[model samples]
Every structure is written in structure tokens, then in C-alpha cells.
Target: MTDADAQTAPDADVTQLEELSVTANRVDGPQAAVGSAISSISGEELEQRQIRVVSDVLRELPGVAVNRTGPAGAATAVRIRGSEANQTLVIVDGIRVNDPGTSGEFDFANLLNLEVERVDVLRGPQSALYGSDAIGGVINIVTRKGEPGPPRFRASIEGGSFKTMTGTASVSGGTEAYDFLFAGQGFSTRGVSTASRFDAVVPTRSLDHDGYKSGTGLAKVSVRPTEALEFTGVARYTEFDADRDGFGATSDGYPFAAAVDNRDTEKGKQFFGRAQAKATLLGGAWDHILGLSYTNQDRRSFAGTDLKTYASLGEMTRFDYQTNVRFETQGALPASHVLTFGADHTRDAVKSFTAFPFPADAPNPLRKHIDNAALVGQYQIGFFEKLFVTGSVRRDFNDRFEEATTYRFASAYTFDQTKTKIRGSWGTGVKNPTTFELFGFSGNYVPNSDLKPERGEGWDVGVDQPIWDDRIVIDATYFQQRVRDLISSETVPDPGDPTGFVNRPINLAGTSKIDGVELGLTLKPINGLTLRSAYTFTDGQDATGATLVRRPTHIASFNANYAFLDDRANVNLGVIYNGRQRDLAYDAATFARTSVPLKAYTLISLAASYKLHQNAEIYGRVENLFDKNYEEVLTYNTPGRTAYGGLKVSF
Candidate 1:
């Protein structure tokens, strides 16, 4: 289902509360019927809040944490329920976008909300449906498609602090025979300094402003020649350039202190394309779908005085083909049953190049490739018409590792009299080692070809209830996960030298455990007014009983939106609170690891919009309304009290 099918709240209107979600089970169905922890944000809500980056939108989500190296366009990491950044799978238009060459991690800083219609975050293990790298969760981003109406056009422009500016344009329309949509966006900003001095004792560094620029484009088309057959195609591309700080440069160490000016820049390009066909047979009881997808990514980092003397390049390409079949019987056992099965094959390859010193000969580029195949099956059964149970299994074969099998079971029960539901799910997940982890760089890392895949088992139980004439909805979930063979780097004595040490990746002998509780409340006290609040409490520990790094113990957010003046104007307010956390920093002088405590911080934002005509509107927003000084990462600068205004025209 599309984002326009339902309101902001999951249970805003009890009669029309069945919002279809495909991320939970890889099939379209009511979100409430799925026995898992899930949440979504619509494009309309994102526009109202004036949010442009995907990372900003995810900070308020339950069971999620965001850490950035600096301000806008900087490297950003997203952690779900205390899991590692690479453990969560990121999917865009049904294709995995994680970078295979970089520890299988997806950087959220580059994911702009240009033509996105909806974002669904599914918490906990989902390997039975999505395969590897789903040990933590899945983030599915659905792009906008044509609407079934007259052709529409839209344009928007905005400017904010730090010399930031953005512009976007889109066109979408649909007919009985064909539908299409196209969108483009451009963004640029002169951001704050990525690194801070901390104290006067530190060596002097260039106080230059980091700059970022990006362009994004999306196109989608669908055609239906017959009533039972359809075809769809999608393409997306993004190009970005960012000025960044030197690596390993902190108060303790300044590698470029002698240089008068640092010229460090990072450039990247990403592209994805997919084509699919669907057909119905056996009098509509059987449905079949075939899909093919391709992805390509290239990144380059430049450093030194000339900005080209020293450089590194990383590239990745992947191709996948999948087929799925769904069968429904007229008369099933007990009540009714829907059976689904699918198989997919994927090939991925990576190449890297690096030049150590100025004008030095580039090392021989490293290239690697791997193949994967998987088969999956799922069955959903309904008993007494109110209780639903789903069971799924998957088997995966990897060229570099051992074969693995995963399974999941989930159930949901609804009480018609009280409009309450109870749901629970248990699942197993796996994450294979990435190319970077298995093969070391030129001289920095040590390769370990025998590294094992990380494995996890997790479960969650939750309740959803509606009260006050269905105007208020509340949900609470408790979840726990245990992971084995956790991957980490250790300093080991070099094989060639007696006194030298090298960092090597290895699997930890002990297991890591993470558990959390999530609570959500939605209120629609009156017409044109809505409020939402969510709270999360997470506790994570390794085998050594030390808290995990960068995982907050508590997080909470509250948002309110109201419209008045004959629906011509609206106001939005949001407040977010992040609890204290811990991280480890390396002391260059002493060559020791030190635990650092980060202070807690809160942020408040306000937005308002007014309609000037039927097809035009103006909007303004203030971020960090309180001008609070906070740091999500140590020695990184955060923007304070930024204001922006924009105009949108639609036809």
C-alpha cells in the first residue's frame, strides 16, 4: 500500500487502521497484523517538518540511535537496539544499498529524502526473509510513485544557516495503461569545523569551514498491458562531494599540524536500477513475480597539498535476480492459508586502490568477488478468524563461508470486543564477514580468511491498545537479542617483528546481549490536531560486562502538529532527549584506550506553514530552538539555532 492510504498515526482511525506494510514479512498486509516491532514515517510528515536528510528523520525513532562525526553531510552511523552499524540492512526500492567494500555499512548521511514516500523500520532479526546482514533490523525506503489522477508538478526551494541551500522538483501522474514519476534535488552547505581544538595545548590546525554538495535523481515507471499482468522499472542516482577532517587527528594527535592548509575531500557516486514483472494465474489464486536489480558505487578520498597527491578509491558492483510465487487455496485447513516461496541469487564484487604518500606509486588494486544463493518459504494461517500465525524458513549458501539456515515464528491475536491486540515473534539472523574484514589494506590491517559469520537469536512481544473512542493509541514492546561470534579488532604481535603490533579482526569468544523496552502513544484529541510520543530504554553489554560504545541507555521524543484557520495554516513542534553514553578514544601519546563519558542533551524544533493559494504555500522552521550546545560525537561540532524558510508550488 502507498503512504497516502492512511493517516500519520498507526491507529488514528480504528475503522481505517489497516495500513499495509511489506517490510515485515516481504508481503503486503496490515501492519497491526504483523507480529513484529515496526514503525513508519510518511513523506507528508517529513515535508511538514522540513527534514531533508534520512539520518535526521531517524533520530526520533524508537530502538534507534544516530551518531555523526560532524555536522551536515558528514559520515553518519545508525545503530538499532545497540547493534553494530553493519548488522542492520538498508534497502532502497527493494534493493540492498549497503557498501560491500566498506565493512558492509550504509552511510545515512548521503541518503537524502528527495523522492521518498515512506520509510519503514523493522526492529529485530529478519534473516528468514532478507538473508545476511539482517541480524539487527531492516530499513526499507519506498520511493514515490505516480498517483491515479491528473498529472501533478511540484517545486520547492529553501535556505538556512551555514550558507545552506536546497532545491527540489518532481512530476508524477498515472493512467489506466501507464504510470510514471520523476524527481530531482540539489543540496549544498558550508558546514562547521568537523574537528575541535578542545584546549590551547593542542597543535594549531586550519580553521577552515567544511563544505558539502550533492545531487539526487529518481525515476520510476509502470505499465499494465492486461488486467492480470504488469511491469515496473526504477532507477536512482546520487553524487556528492564533501570536505572533511583528517583521520586520527584529535587533541592528542595532529598528523597535519605542520601543513598551513589541509585540503581533504571525499567524493562518491551511487546508482541503483531494478525491473520487475508480476502475473496472476489460476483464476487469481496464484501470483508470480520476477525481479532483476543492479547496483554500483564508487568513492574516492583525496588528501595532501595538491588535493590529488594522495588518494584512495573504493568501488563495488552487485547484481541480483529473484522469483517469488504465492498460492492461495479456496478451502484451506481450519480457516485460511497463504503460502509464499522465493529464491534469489546475487553476485557482488569490490575493487580498491590506494596511494600512500605524495606522488608515490599506487599499490596494485585489490579485487574480490563472491556469490550467494538463498531459498525462502513462508506460511500464514488464520484460526477462528481472529488469531493469525506465521512461520518462515530460509537457507543460504555463500561462496566464502559455510551454509546457514534460519527460521522465524510469529503470532498475533486480536480482541474484537476491546480493540486490543497481542503479538510476538522469534527469529534467527546471520551476518557474513565483509570483504574488508577478511582482506587487509596495504599495510594497516591483517587479513583473516577463516573469520566466521556472526549469528543472533532474538524475540519480542508487544501489545497495541486503543482508548478514548479510538482517539488515543498506545503500544509497548519488550525485546531481547543475543549474538555470538561478535567481530572485533585486536592488537596482535606482528608475525615478522618481535616488538611491532598489528590490528587484526577476529571473532570474540563470548556473546553479546542487548535488551530494550519501547513505548509509544498517539493522541488525536481534536480535529486537525495530532500528538505522538515515544520512549526507549536500552541496555547492552559485551562478554566482559562493559557497556557498548555509542549506545544510549534512554531516548525519548514528543511531537505535535495542529492545523487551524480553515486549514490554511499549520504548526508543528518537536522535542527530543538523548541520555548520556560512553565511547573509547585512543591516546596517541600513551597508545592507550580511554573511556570517555558524553554528556546528555535535548533539542527542540518548531515549524509552521501557511497556504497562499490552492497550489502554493510558504513554510518556515527553526532547528535547535533553544540554541543548546550538544555533541553526538566527541570533538565534533554541532549546529545551533538554525532557521530556514521556503516556498512550494504544486499543480
Candidate 2:
């Protein structure tokens, strides 16, 4: 479909969202018919922009913040609409990928855009449709599917500064009854120093280059045994290793003192698989789907010098089963009344081992597990063919915490004559505490089994207007969220040792608030030229009236793309700006917290591609074009100017 058609289409599903289609409701419909703020990026567009990492791709999105600890392959956190890193839910190919062992947060540093085809970002609470950990929003990643044409194979290789190298290969094809797709990718880089440079009174280790390497593979297969039944399966795996620095005390009193001869290393692996079966019944008016999914993650870290050694290992396993049913009305007001119901069960378990005090002794292996079941239902109706409304509810039962119920209501109205649409939504969400929060370590942390779940209520209203015969689109939205029973670490008296104190998790009585306004504009002034821009203003504060750390008050981005030579060549340019933010610093000796101001910075990027032949292409990209010196986190070093070039061939 043409860009204009894709942008204006009213009825779009998950597959169409990346093509400029929007669907507010999970059951599927036109974006104009659902009441929620949503955004999406197509895989084709991402490839054109030379966005290789998941963190880089999400940096400029509205109402989103990406904080990286260091350069590439370092720990990265994504916050949505002022929510904490663990409050947002991330789904890959219909499976949740959050690491249960790490406060239930997903690290974007290791997620590469290798076989991804589309990304749908739904802003606002989504607990009613997606159970726990969806208090902020939901991110859905869809992978490429085989095409019903001759088999195709493609490969590409690239190298750049920092001794970075990358290679990718893929094969896909489909027939009348069967289809399959397989892809593999590998990347390696001799990264820069992860720690910032600081003067030290005592001699310290010389600046050493950290390095990272990763390999990933994906496979998918689908079959249609009969006219009424279909089956599909998917599998994915990734392994990575990275070198890191250590934190030590310096004579200057800075807590983030560089360790001499640091030789820390981290290794991790992830695997996920899913199988699904779908059936159509009652003359295609009713549909049923059943799916089973499994995920496993392992992480190991080694730190310290020759005389002393510290190591830790963490592993997590998850199993999930889900079934869904949808019914279509036989009679309607020129529109269908869709009803959907689903249930799911999930079990998560973790095992961890660690050695403390310079390889002297090892602590007992820690093991924990949690399970939850949820039932969800949704109803959608259209009246007079111009107004639509939807309501959804979910009931969840957790093995460790109290049961919870979440609900959402939304509506949309369209003025076809003026090409204007108004939409609004209200919802409630919840997040259960992680295992580590409930049960602490051997010596450092204390357990808090009495902790309650974090609760949130939020709402949003927005409008979409089309101008210049739908060639230009404008969107504006306002949203607010209040969170109760905020969880935080607090110093408490140690029961086992009356003379000592320890850090323990506690639920605060006061509430935290987050509110924001988002604005976006898209213009297609010419057939081969496109321009887009987005801006967000956020106000995030704690109950004590203190600004949240690492959250910028203002964020904006502008992008332009132009194609020439009969669509054989294209150039893309983009700029991102982040405003000053408030943060905190702790004293090395006293451990006293002090407020700090983080300066703002802007970055520019450029990418270009040219078709060498009917089945081959050449591409190149420049990141941080001006080599702007900035840090997303204090005491962390960021990458400077970098460039890469690659060639791709398809048959």
C-alpha cells in the first residue's frame, strides 16, 4: 500500500500497524476506532534508518526514555511515560521476555533488530489485556513471516570503527500449505572504556578497552493441515559475552573510582519457543486459538583482581499456556460487534549462586518460584458507524500476593466530513513484587514478605486530524498516571542482629504522579519525500515533591527521508534532543545522597542506501555525526562518532 493509504486506513490489525495502521484494541480494528495513544515503526523503515539495536530504535519515541550505563552492549533501561524500568511489558512474537531473576525487567542492550518486521508501542496502562507488569505500557515485537513466493536468500556484512564487525543471513519461502523462515546474525566490537576518566590521588589501572560479542538465530514454520485448522511454531536463541569495569574507592572521595587492572566479565544466554494452533468454526464467525510458550535465561558474572575474586550466576525458566476465543455478531448496525475472551497461566522460577569476600566462601544457592493465572474478556461495539466503544476486564490470582482485578474503558468518535477523530481511555494496572524484593541476599539485603503490589490508575485523551487531503497528519495527546504503594529500599533494623541495620523493601504510603503531553506531525509533501517530528513534555514527581531521576522534562526528534534515482537510492537524516534532568550522587565514604543536575545534549545521525542491481544493494550510516560529548549516566562513558558500510544480496 502507498504511504498515504497506509496512514489513513481505518481498519488495521497487528500486521498492518507497522504499515501506518493503528489498532487501539487488542482484538483488532481500525486505530481511529480505539481510544488510546499508539505508535509503530515498520522493519523496512528501521533498516533504512540503520537502527540496529532495540535501545537505539526506541530512543526518540514519544513518552519514552532510554538510559544506558555505558557504550554498546552495556545495561540499558527503558522507561515509559515516567514509569519505572520494570513497569513496562515487552512481548516478542506473543511471548513475554522479561527476566524474572532481575526484578522482572528486560535489558534492551542485548536485543538486536535481526529478524524483526514490526514494532507496536501502545502507550498507557494495559493490564486489562496483558496481565502484570503492564502499568506503564506494552511493546509488541512481530517477526518476519515467510512469503508465498519463490524461496529467497539474503546476506550482508559490515565493519566499522572500534573494530566492530557484523554479519547476517536469512532464508524464507512458502507454498500453498507450508511456509518456513530462518535467520542468523553475529556481531563483535572492541568497545571503548566503560568508565569515565577521573583524577586519582593513587595510581590506578590504565584505561583499557572493553569488548562484546553476540550471536543469534531464529526459526519459524507454519502448516495448514486442513481448511479449518492451522499450526505455527517459532524458536529463537541468543548468546553474548562482554567485558566490564569495577567500582572502587579513590583517594579523591568519588564513589565511582576506577579499579586498577579491572578484569570483570559477563556472559549471558537466552532461548524462547512457542507453538500455536488456530481453528475457525461456525461458518467463520467464531475463532479459537491455543498456544504454549517457554523461555530460559542464564547469566554469569566475574569480577575482582588476582588476589580476590567474586562471581555470580543466575538462571530463570518460564512456561506459559494461553487460549483465546472470539465471536462475531451475525446482525449489526452495518458493523460487527466483536467479543473476545481468553485465559492464561504462567510459572516463573529462578536459581542463583554467588561467592562473596574474595573467594573465601560461597553462599547457599537461592531458589524461588511464582505462578499466576488470569482470565480476560473484552467487548467492542459500533453505533451509527461513526462511534465506537470498548470495555475490558481481567482477574488475576497470584501465588504469592493478593488477587487483583484490572479494567479499562475507551471510546472513539469520528467526523468523516472534517476528517477529525477524538479518542479517550481510562485504565487500572498492577505490578507484583519480584522474588528478590520479597527475599533478600545472604548478608546485604533483608526480606520483605509483607510487601504489597504496586497499583496504578491512568487515563489519556487524544485527537487525530488529517489535512491536505490526508497527506499531512497531526496528533496530540495528554496523559496522567498516579501510582500507590510505591516500593523502595529503606534502612531497617536487622532482626537477626539487633546491633546492625540492613536495607529492606517497603511500600510507601504516599503516591507518585506522572503526567505528560505528546505532539506529533507527519508530512508527505512529495511522492519521494517524507518528514516527521514528535515532541513530549513530562512532569514526574515523588510524593515529597522531588523530581524523578534520569527523566528529562522535554524530549523531541525530527526526521527526514528522500528518495531519488527512481527509488533506487535514498537518504535519511534525523536529530534528537534531550533536556536537562535531575539526578542524585552519593559520597564514597559517608554515603550521603546529594542532588545533581545532568546537562542536556543533542545528536545527529545520517544514513544512505543505493541499489547496485536488481537483487543487490549497498548501504552506509554515520552515528553521532558531530561526536557530541554527552553521558546518559554519571561516571559512564558514551560512544563517539562511528560509521559502518555493508552490502546485501538477495536471490
CA-lDDT, candidates in order: 0.76, 0.76
Which lDDT tens digits does candidate 2 get at residues 567-637?
A: 99999998999889876664443334466888998999999999999899999999999999997876778
TM-score of every model versus the real structure: 0.92, 0.92
The collision pairs in model 2 are 22-31
Q: Candidate 1: minimum summed lDDT over ten consecutive residues — where?
A: 1-10
Query: Stretches of candidate 1 above 4 Å error?
Result: 1-17, 198-206, 249-261, 304-334, 357-363, 493-501, 589-592
Model 2: residue 100 alpha-carbon error in angstroms:
0.4
Most accurate candidate by lDDT: 1
Encode model 1's per-residue lDDT on 1-651: one tens digit a residue: 111111111321112234533345565444444777787777777877778888787887789999988878988999888889999988787667778767787888888888787777888998998788888898877778898889999999999899999999999999988899999999999987776652224445457787899999999998999888878888899999998766443454453221122447888888877777777677656666777777777777777334442223334333333333444345455565667777777776777666642113323466777788888888877665578788989998899888999998888888889979898999999998887677535444566778999999999999888899879989899999899998977766666667655566889888999999998888999999989888999999876677888899999998898989998999999999999999766544322356678899999999999999999999999999999998887667778899998999999
